[model samples]
Target: MSGGAMLSLDGVHAVYGRKIRALRGVSLEVRAGEVVALIGNNGAGKTTLMKTIAGLLAPEKGRVTFQGRALSGLPPHEVMRMGLSLVPEGRRIFPRLTVMENLEMGAYSRAHGAELAREYEHVFTLFPVLGRRRAQLGGTLSGGEQQMLAMGRALMAAPKLLMLDEPSMGLAPVVVDKIFEIIARINQEGVTVLLVEQNARRALKAAARAYVLETGEIVSAGDSASLLRDPAVQKAYLGL
Candidate 1:
């Protein structure tokens, strides 16, 4: 799992406005078939890094490479077409759309036919609640259901690398546990995951390796178990 690099960011720098920097000389890599967690506080540039990788935002300096191809100025759609799918922080499903419709929208980049149908079935298999609620409006579902929908939507892309931003946000503890379980299951199925989570313990537990970001910088990085046991990480992120 760690032998090949699926994605890499070398000295990446990203900014919100001309003057406000969001990431500064940040660098990391996601190896093939590994779950890599990026954990940080509220304003720690976690979402900004995901957007940069997904091509919603471009780096001011450095490069983003996926599967050996550079993704520096590509549009989001182009990035998606190249096998990177991002489940954004908020469950931004179409409020007016039905569950099935929202899922269909996720397959817009894919060809229509048997392959698409199989992907739909795959999503349904991963999330049976979605299969049961196929006709429900996206906005009507519970927070956990909506989060499942978001993940299902991303899986529709058949991504080689799945980028999840705050998948546990605004959910009950049990729901969060279930979500993390599903995420681990997803990784087991061979989709490399780059997960951005503020829940440090859970994130560390889920990922093989972890990086801690603070004020646009990667302050700590190592194997997840070591980071979890580190005195600094425990005090700062785990409330120990």
Candidate 2:
């Protein structure tokens, strides 16, 4: 692993069922305190890669290391305990749970007391609306609010590496902007973010580095500015 890399995936491969291949020799690194974007089309194995890293799925080949610790055979809960949290796609907040309940679920592995209370305050500070609606059922919130709640829930874990998948999907343009703004703010506060997003343009703008995935493999990767300017990337992803 590189000295500064907080997360590293080396030639990783994952499959589904038995025959369906999802990731193909994927390799990437998320450096400490950097927001690295993974942009890809609908079926491009982006989520697969995220799941693999989070220990939701075991890779068939290669290695996944976080903070220099091998994560290959660990379970999801163990991975979470190691300071890696994933806010999965679809803002999967518990509909029946109140906002506060959902956030508490995120901290299940954490100790009870002052530290846990501080995490709640921290999340509320980031999304004051959540604080205001702490008693409301999560299902009652709007799409944007639900997204915020999901992010806040993940933050409750105090993760050093936060992986966000498709955070802006199915939201209005203005809402998307707000989401990205918060993402930048989170990164600035020292979280190493690995963001998988469908809105390639917004992802590139928010990220310092980016990788392009296609059909389960990485097709391009570079500094965000260079990737944004590449003719192929512009034409295929940026709609320019």
Worst lDDT 10-window in candidate 1? 1-10
Best by the lDDT measure: 2
C-alpha positional error of residue 176 in candidate 2 after TM-score superposition, expressed in Å: 0.9
lDDT of every model, 2 decimals: 0.93, 0.94
Candidate 1 local lDDT, 126-223, one digit each (tens): 89999999999999999999999999999998999999999999899999999999999999999999999999999999999999999999999999
User: By TM-score, how accurate is candidate 2?
Assistant: 0.97
| Runs of candidate 2 exceeding 4 Å displacement | none
lDDT of 2 at 164: 97
Clashing pairs counted in every model? 0, 0
Q: How good is model 1 by TM-score?
A: 0.97
